[model samples]
Target: MSGRLQHKVAIVTGSGSGIGLESSLLFASEGANVVLADVNLPSAQKGADLIKDRYPTVKGIAVKCDVGKEEDVKAVVDLAVREFGRLDVMFNNAGIMHPEDDNALNTEDRIWDLTMRINVKGVWWGSKYAVLAMRQNPTDEAKGLHVGGSIINTASFVAVVGSATPQIAYTASKGAVLTMSRELAMVHAREGIRVNSLCPGPLKTPLLMDFLNTDEKKQRRLVHLPMGRFGEAIEQAKAALFLASDESSYVTGTDFMVDGGLTNAYVTSIGEPTLPPPSSLI
Candidate 1:
């Protein structure tokens, strides 16, 4: 509604469902041209179609991307630049919590590798490609376009704290994402790019709800939530909107927690731009 991302071009990965879809729609509503990327082509296309149906003024395109593959990651960024002429935001939001991933002793090597490839390596490839394009972003003073952009990677509350439930692979991957974001933020700060990791708390998403089918199972996690309510996808999307917009121009390299007071410990840390590129918080 604020049109904070007006005329900006953004790529949101894992945009087929969950919080990714919510952010894509929110971005479009804020006057951004969105490129919805997912391994599932149809779902990503649906997001694009929804954008076309509701916000006809902005452009929406869908691309099939498996974040685990470097080529797929590069291709999507290329498509965004080719179609929109520049990339303003890159949200490396795609990740997996493999059901098979559990306690270290029980979790198989195959499962760990698979989870790492998509969760940790995916964000890495996504960031690598994002920085490449953001460096070449064309400047257009009239439209408020600049050469640098924002990069957001989706982590989780477990990244900063321990989880007795123990999705070890997933927890480890998110930790990597958070640390990697901080390092990337500093490396490219002078180049005018901002990078941050978004950590969402327990959510009441369909996937999570289905998993927490019983009240006993639900309360097991809810007891830790001071809010006593599971977070909604929109809440996480809103936090992401902040990271993607110029409002967070000076905010980077930190864990942008949307965890509803689930965890208090935060990793503190940021960039330059026509919108005032991020400044390191160190």
Candidate 2:
């Protein structure tokens, strides 16, 4: 049987590792031509190679792209269109977090700027170029098939709720991303393009592992999460596939929370629990 993305073309940024990499591979496996774009050229190439090796008949290419840079973002989208003849989906997934500065007060100006540039501005640039490319394609009805594209931005549950330990800049930037996705979705609804944000709680990616390396940190973090476990990269990739594919054709301007119920439940106070007064005291 043909896959959901058969013959479609997609561009996934930060696809060298973690969720982006897994999603790129999945997209290719589902018959979409994938462009694996990342700042790390070797890693991006490796991801492309892996996909090509598995699916020899499918097309997969790697391009070095720093999403924060408008020029690089344009080049990535242009390359995808040039090589594949069209762009069907764009995944804006490149992001960074500074380990040394977890709290707002302790974060330096440079760190704050870097996080915003990559996490917030990067999504804006990607959407700008992706929409431009999608516009070039004939309208769904005119093309004789429903073929307007989709844009998926990566956000985090921290954007929805405050974290016990603050990564203030990262959280704030992602919150902006969520809102941006909604606004862009509304603006482009009539154009037949869909925009949505995916919010993954805590995943077992290298970035998260680096922050929660110790047993003590793991225990502390687990208490806040009702699932008591870190999510896998593939899990996030599956969510991306839903948003990217026609499965979510009618779903746009919404936030998909892949948080394992962390955002839904409340944890008790870290050190103390509430108790009823003794009968004698009453």
Prediction RMSDs, each to the true structure: 10.0, 3.3
Candidate 1 lDDT, 1-282, residue by residue in tens: 568999899999999999999999999999999999999999999999999999999989999999989899999999999998889999999988776777889999998998899998999999998999999998989878898999999999989886647578888988999999999999999988999999999898875676566888777677677676889999999999999998998998989889878796232110111243467433
Clashes of 1: 6
Alpha-carbon shift of residue 213 in model 2 (angstroms): 3.1
Q: What is the lDDT of residue 239 in candidate 2?
A: 94
- Best-fitting candidate, measured by lDDT? 1
lDDT of 2 at 213: 74
TM-score of 2: 0.92
Residue pairs in candidate 1 whose N, alpha carbon or C atoms collide under 3 angstroms = 270-280, 271-277, 271-278, 271-279, 272-277, 273-277
- TM-score, candidate 1, is 0.91
TM-score per candidate, chains pooled: 0.91, 0.92
The stretch of ten residues in a row with the least summed lDDT in candidate 2 is 138-147
lDDT of each: 0.89, 0.88
